[model samples]
Target: MSEKKNEGNSVSRRSFLRNGALAAAGFMIVPRHVLGRGFVAPSDRLRVAAVGVGGKGYGDITSFAEGRADIAFLCDVDKRRAAKAITTFPKAKFYTDYREMFEKERKNFDAVSVSTPDHQHAVAAMAAMQLGKHVYVQKPLTHDIYEARKLTEAAKKYKVVTQMGNQGASGDGVRQLMEWYNAGLIGDVHTVYVWTDRPVWPQGVAWPQTNATIPAELNWDLWLGTAPKKNFVDNLVPFNWRGWWDYGTGALGDMGCHLIEPPFRVLGLGYPSSVEASVGSVYVGEFNRGYFPESCPPSSHVTMKFPVKGGKEVTMHWMDGGIQPERPEELGPNEMMGDGGNGVIFVGTKGKMMCGTYGINPRLLPTSRNAEVNVPQTIARVPEGHYLQWVNAAIAGYNSKEAKSLSSPFDIAGPLTESILMGNLAIRSYDYREAKIDGKGYNYPGRYIKLLWDGPNMKITNFDPANQFVKRTYREGWSLGV
Candidate 1:
């Protein structure tokens, strides 16, 4: 397939001379590899600049530099968080602000690695793309629907290599799922369920009333890039932001990509036509329902409707905050369903299939069937794992054969992210309310509404107000070029 052309291109001598000319002009210099993608000398490694080089960000850059490339620059809002990366790559220049890093080291690195919070992913990646550098961004792509769409288009417009951090996309499990689907093992998967026990962070709570002092090692303003200005709250940084609307998208955003990718890849699914949701409530004291607009509910269940390749459609159910679907009777009493913490189950006409996070431990219904049934492996696997998939692709350059084979390039990640965020839109819209005409009570106008989606237009057809969530307005100084 043209989409999988990373391994099939033949290079000519003319391209080599052009590479030479670019190098002579002080462009990204590197040695040519025998694979014909780019240079391969040990000393000529692809140079990478990393933003938010801590936590998952640290793991990302470390994987990129794991004997394959040079960690040329490091940037993070909190030095305390990025401590490991700073010491790990002692020679990699460090910066508190990623804007300064890109501006100063524009020509130093051939690629950029972005592991910032969901809100900042787009701006940092776009800056790198604007400078003609390849980028590997973390999953769920962007915080808002418009940002995701913009980045997806930019990948092609700028002709840059791109990969999202949903590592399961590159795993053999999803490939196996695809092969099984191609073999008609799960015929016409009409109903599906994906559940997670996340929100390991706080949710369904009101914002802290007291303002706390900013940590000495953290740049609070830089960390809040694109997010509206807010007073520092204790324990909001490093973690726990997952529950808040401004900096995070709750448990769904944290784990949706991993659990949902199996169905998306296997069934060749696209945008959903409609989505509806019901959220778990946290009661204040014993009677009153707590209202926390800034926080995600403690639990939620979202249902989405999507039309398949045929005229028929499929229904998907997503649950989080320790909730799960009823266990199928096909398995033993003590059998595992989606590895306990997170899992996916596809209910098809013929049979059922399931997997855990990152599409791992895929199995057909009736546990013994995994070994008894065999399907041809039609899809290729990423040999070195997800992080390195981006590394190798970047070294191969934009539009090169290698870049085409990426598992979660923007083209693939964009729609997937949009679909995931659509669930959030439904969840948020579910809470839409108005002051009652009586002036003494409140009314939930959005309750019981199955929001219709116009995917191409990025809007809700029936409810006009819900469109506000589709593309958020950034703060005064923050912009996504939207």
Candidate 2:
């Protein structure tokens, strides 16, 4: 697409409403309360298809199917998963390949819920939107930074009601946190410590020891999708793929959207000025193979510096693999730190607000005041469920003020995804050099430098090679287009 064309298709409030109205006219309209209550009236039932019906995918489908949406199609590379999902929607058609599902059943679905791995999110969502189907895509919006940008562009071009799968975006807790921040409870935030105990679920301490045979039930080629082909290993299939560099974005990408989204939303954080990483590795022999490639540091500690629209700087630190910053002494003996996996602790000039992935019921505190700070009531509350919001939006079109208000379009989702991926890039760069923090006198090995960014140019002025990782070549026939 030309620069002009791409810019024109970028997300905007006006475009969102226009597309929403167009989509609403085609689908059956139901009462707003019906959708809000998680029930779909018979006439307003959305004909839906779920791509990547595994782990999270199954949960997303069940949420919709149990509600008012009709599951017309279930697609997965694994027959076991496909079969299991099929039982729930016995009448829904099933497919091993999603492209085939779209081609044959295009007319049947009013919307699609994409629950695929990171690499496949863009392709499946793009295809669905192109067909004029509404989309609810799980977060860390896209596999790579470019894809997130493109998907956001496509959502606008197609005039579809689109939502990122950061379900917490709809939560009342998250909204309250944002309101608190906006109300100056935290007072001029400058730094944040967000850590997760993730990858523990799927991230291996080390890479798989041996390549196990691929199961016959799984279509290994289709599973690889746009990533380079590799021999199928039993450990790499099903759920463990999150540790690998190709299929997943490791711990950061997996949980960044959920954990970092609140700060991003309330702060209106734009692009980062620079990023650096520190981490542990497991390279044992001549060939370097850690849990992730030595080239892609296994347990990463990344710091990103963002120069907001104004002159102020916002620095964020992210660590995975059960690592966490020292807890503030102010937290009372009864105030236990939440689970390590995917949480953010905002450090402001005055106080702090801490939250976990999905930003569920975040807590606020004063540095010295031990007791929890009383926060006032706010107007916005997180929506009931992320998936349900998208469904309602798809049916009513952008015209439903309720749906538009609850949704997080690509504009918001795209930058958040970009910020998350910065950590990944910093991890990769750490393998090459030493880095220095802005104010800290400490210098460390394998530290990535903070390169200035030009978002529109998609370039890092000081880092030439780093810019290349932002975009990747897609396998033929599977590549996305404007």
Writing each residue's lDDT as its tens digit, candidate 1 over 156-234 gives 9778889999999999989888888789986889999999999899998889999999999998988887778999999
Candidate 1 wrong stretches, greater than 4 Å: 1-44, 430-444
TM-score of 2: 0.84
Candidate 1 positional error at 48, Å: 0.8
Looking at model 2, report the run of 10 residues with the lowest lDDT sum.
1-10
Residue 387 CA displacement from its true place in model 1, Å: 1.3
User: Model 2, residue 349: what's the lDDT?
Assistant: 83
Tens digit of lDDT per residue, candidate 2, span 1-482?
A: 11111133223223323445444325454575766776745447778889988788888888887656888899999887677787877998888888777766665678888988888888788777877788888887887878888887877777778888887777776787777787887788899888887775455344556787777788888888777767766666676677766778888888888888888877888788788777775544555444334123446688888887567899988888878888866567666564445677888887887876778757876434325456677665544567676777666665567456654777688878987887776565422244432333223332546666777666667766566568767654455644
